[model samples]
Target: DKGELKGAGFSFQVSDAQKYGQAIGHIGKLTSGSLKVGDAVQADVDQARRQRIRLNHSATHLMHAALRQVLGTHVAQKGSLVNDKALRFDFSHFEAMKPEEIRAVEDLVNAQIRRNLPIETNIMDIDAARESGAMALFGEKYDDRVRVLSMGDFSTELCGGTHASRT
Candidate 1:
């Protein structure tokens, strides 16, 4: 029951051009000196800033697992937004998660606080990732080469998000 469900397509159509265009537009806007607004950083984004943001995002995956473990068995990711200081995860569940559930989720996430698990990245042919048993997210695609991000053995996904070197 824990294995991946392969080749199941959603009923919706996604526009690849629109997705790439939106990504490019955002990058352009950030580089256009409009990102910082009134902040002290003043629209300056460097490698160090990116790495710092990645550290927080790595925590978000743990958050997803925590939610699933506490929230019954119906949770499925619906959407998300990730930025420098914070990370947001959205999932499919008929009812709202209860307050107690939220606390339980947080506590579970916090339990991994002191563990140090190294994160690893592999760039291999798409076939390699599938053959290696990586969990492919719904509605995701892979080219000839895909990037696999892993947190020890906790979670391994084909993603384009910032990440921590280790957990």
Candidate 2:
């Protein structure tokens, strides 16, 4: 591979990435030029976009704790989607959330956000994490060692996602 600038203003960006077996695949669109299998290239991440993603990811943890407080301990995370634009958290709940309940949850989350609690992450055995009351997603398998992310005493969960340094 030649150390050459292939093209400028080519509007090429990685739209999606996933892992299959032991390999990772980057899916993207190239506006110009053809690339051979071994062509060398540099990848730059948009730091601002990544910051937004971290903020949203951390917010989800706060929201989860708020939901449990307001909607009862039965609330369990079913799924989640986190990106720079937004975070969608799905959880188990029987009835539609009333407006007041929604507002209460928002207030609780906002209060924590205002505190700007420092985020802490620790790697420990899965059993120890469970004993520490770290919430894990149902039906999800985890290795013997796990990451336990905590935001003060308010929230703690088993997570492998990126998070902001503070609430």
Candidate 3:
């Protein structure tokens, strides 16, 4: 959500924020504005950019699951970046991925994509989410309530991002 502050300062909204803070509900960077606390907000969306990001984000999850399947359960995601062009994933691995291992991961992700698995989302207590076997990123903070994203029976993780209804 975004909006302009109606005043002499002429504050304009630049972009929406993702993660919430303790004091700030939504923290967005301003391009040219002098916004203050208690400013009213409105939803502003760029449909095309959002669509591309969604695709990349969902692909990141798929790749995460495929990595575990092909590599090992010890594989833990270190970080990830998703943009309109691609999704870059960094993970903890003992050694460089072998060619066959990389190909196997690709094949697994492709097979799931071909299946067109239904994407399911549910809001639940954080503890319940963990009990449900949802994979969560280490060091990431979670509230009492969390959103769980499950890709068919293939992947289940804690995420708060746009995703397609199907794989």
Candidate 4:
């Protein structure tokens, strides 16, 4: 009940950010603090960690494109996790990927990475984005206005995630 700030170096650790209706909320854990109504606080992001996350997120997009090229156009992103350390991508496929197929996907992504292609982002109407050939994740909900990210001609998708300036 008391608005007491404890600990010599108390800080709020934000774990997740979500949108609820028109408002955005950050859910987190407080080390030692009693945050009541109207408690003002400052937020800061770790730039280096954020950079790593961006790199991983961009890599995920590139990998998705490579998978579709190597496998088939039927390949679609099922799920994905992008973090500072690594990226895990799940997709739809008829069968397990062969070793050579894996290598080909890796090679394609690596070649694009070597090129250091610049990443471009645009916000447009959903229909316009789709008409421009931006791939959207199946069964995923999107706003009327969407963010389309493209990396040269290698990859283009509807994404709101942070990304590196170049592959």
Poorest stretch of ten by lDDT in candidate 4: 1-10
lDDT value for candidate 4? 0.87
Model 1 lDDT-worst window of ten: 1-10
TM-score of 2: 0.84
Q: What is the lDDT of residue 94 in candidate 3?
A: 99
**CA lDDT, every prediction?**
0.63, 0.86, 0.83, 0.87
- TM-score of candidate 4 on Cα atoms, chains taken together: 0.85
List the lowest-lDDT window of 10 residues for candidate 2: 1-10
Number of backbone clashes in candidate 4: 0
User: Per-residue lDDT of 54-165 in model 2, one digit per residue for the tens?
Assistant: 9999999999999999999999998888888999999999999999999999999999999999999999999999999999998899999999999998999999888999
Considering lDDT, which of the candidate structures 2 and 4 is the better prediction for this target? 4
Candidate 3 colliding pairs, count: 1
Give the TM-scores of the predictions, in the order they appear.
0.64, 0.84, 0.79, 0.85
Candidates by lDDT, descending order: 4, 2, 3, 1
- Candidate 3 Cα errors over 4 Å, as ranges: 1-18, 22-44
Return the TM-score for candidate 3, rounded to 2 decimals.
0.79
- lDDT by residue for model 4 (8-56), tens: 3566677666678888676677866556656666666567888998999
